[model samples]
Target: MPITRRSAMTLPSLLAAPALAQPTRPIRMLMGFPPGGPTDFVGRLTANGLQDQIGQTIVFENRPGANSVLAAEAVARAAADGHTLLFASNSLAMNASAYARLPYDPTTSFAPIAMVATSPNVLWCGTSQPWHSLDQLVAAAKAQPGTLGYASTGNGGNGHFGGETLRQALGIDISHIPYRGTAPALLDVIAGRVPLMMQTMVGAIGPYRENQLRPLVVFGPNRAPELPDVPTLKELGHEVPDSGVWFGVLAPAGTPPPFVMRVSHALQAMLEKPESRAQLASQASVPAYLGPDDFAARIRTDVTNWADVARRAGIRPE
Candidate 1:
């Protein structure tokens, strides 16, 4: 039978019917950090909002190791279905420069979804430390040179990079002490094992509030709302602005465009919720929602920027 215009239109609709009829499944959000860390904390929070809006359970799977390479590789290899997602942070962007070789291409291995939020890295000193402010700390580091030790969550983490940047910018020689994680580093700082550390605002807030650690400066363009008393690095004559960690979502490359938009829209809707905003604020994080294009651009910019920092600091991954 010859197809008429009406039948042709109906044929197109028939082809689309199966796609529309497919049942939605639970989305798996892969996080590269262990539970209770900043990345995992934000991942779980965002997952809750996503689940609420998408009407599907968002399961969080932790595949932490090798500076998040394990999780990144897993997500990179996963099918480009909307059901699997990756919750990533600055580490993913930084790894491009930090590691000499990686199994996955950070820029092209995944489809950028949305930038979730940015948080400052708090410049903290042990409560027992003599330095009262950032200026005092810088002066002390200059005076002591390599004797002044600063702790980091790990060798290639944001905290380490932040500390390294400060060292290079201020022309100081503070020693870098690597810890397994931020909690252990914070504990060591509180015990006066190390004099200083650059920690995420989420991890440092409680210690700062309790006076276990003194926040001297925040690596943000402006003072964070939770730490109004603390000055920014820029305020202290450092040109460094907003060199902190950011969290974002990504899907394996080649995921259908509709699926990407669906997840992105769900995240944007979640960010608009009053409760979500409140929860993020309570952790000293400001919610930032950057769509796919903008988020990918930011990632590229950061990778280049941190690469320079790594070069200046003479850091070479082992």
Candidate 2:
């Protein structure tokens, strides 16, 4: 027998439907970076919070390569049933301008859930280096242009562009030495092979605390709470402001609107927890809660902002 329209329009039956039908299944969160990086660390923390809040297991899958393009593609191609999500970061948005072509469109290949957190990047030098502050470092770089080399995760990474932006902004010349990852680059800096590098406050915190690295200036409007003594680039006489890194959640494009909203609400609840807030603060990250539309707007703004930075720095990635 054909179902009647009056029966299908019953509000009680529709209202009884589960918001997340697969509530018991393990949710897969994909990370573009490797295990020990900030992205992985924060992703795991977020998963833990969500697991406790949503009463489901959240698993993290690491697919590290090609500047996180592999993971982004995997998430973009995954089933849009809300079980699979991407722990997207600045790399995804920056790649839009860094790479000439990508397997997926960053802006449209995924549904924005909520921005997890944001942290400033710090310009740090090896402890053994003579320069102690931004002013001193710029003075030395100006005296010997191209002699002071810095290391970054890659040519088109945030650290790379941040370094280049500083060079252009301060009218100094410094050679950039790109590495496969921040770990190796940080090692090089510690060994004095590379004079300096810009890294996330989270990543630099341990090294700085251990006395292996000396922070020069953070690339943000205000100093990082974890490193309150460190001055911002703008505070050091540079006009650069609000240069930081962020992490967010994304589902594959075409994901059901109901599922996306469910996931977003779950994440918002998790972020509101006191434990989650403490975890974020411990990593020097500020929690940023934005709904789908607002998060999408942020992505667009970031793409436009970083595209200009890349263009000005003459960064054309292959």
Q: Native-vs-model 1 lDDT?
A: 0.82
Each model's Cα RMSD:
7.3, 6.8
Worst 10 residues of 2 by lDDT: 7-16
Task: Put down candidate 1 lDDT per residue, 75-131, tens digits, no spaces.
Answer: 999988777889999899888777889889888999998898888888888889898
RMSD of 1: 7.3
Candidate 2 per-residue C-alpha lDDT over 199-300 given as tens digits, one digit per residue, 9 for 90 to 100: 888777778778999988889787888878889888877876355788889999988776666666667767877788898887778787777898898898
What is the lDDT, from 0 to 100, of the residue 59 in candidate 2? 88
Per-residue lDDT, model 1, residue 291, is: 77
Q: Which residue pairs in candidate 2 have backbone atoms (N, alpha carbon, C) closer than 3 angstroms, thus clashing?
A: none
Name the best candidate (by TM-score): 1
TM-score of each: 0.91, 0.89
lDDT of 2 at 181: 84
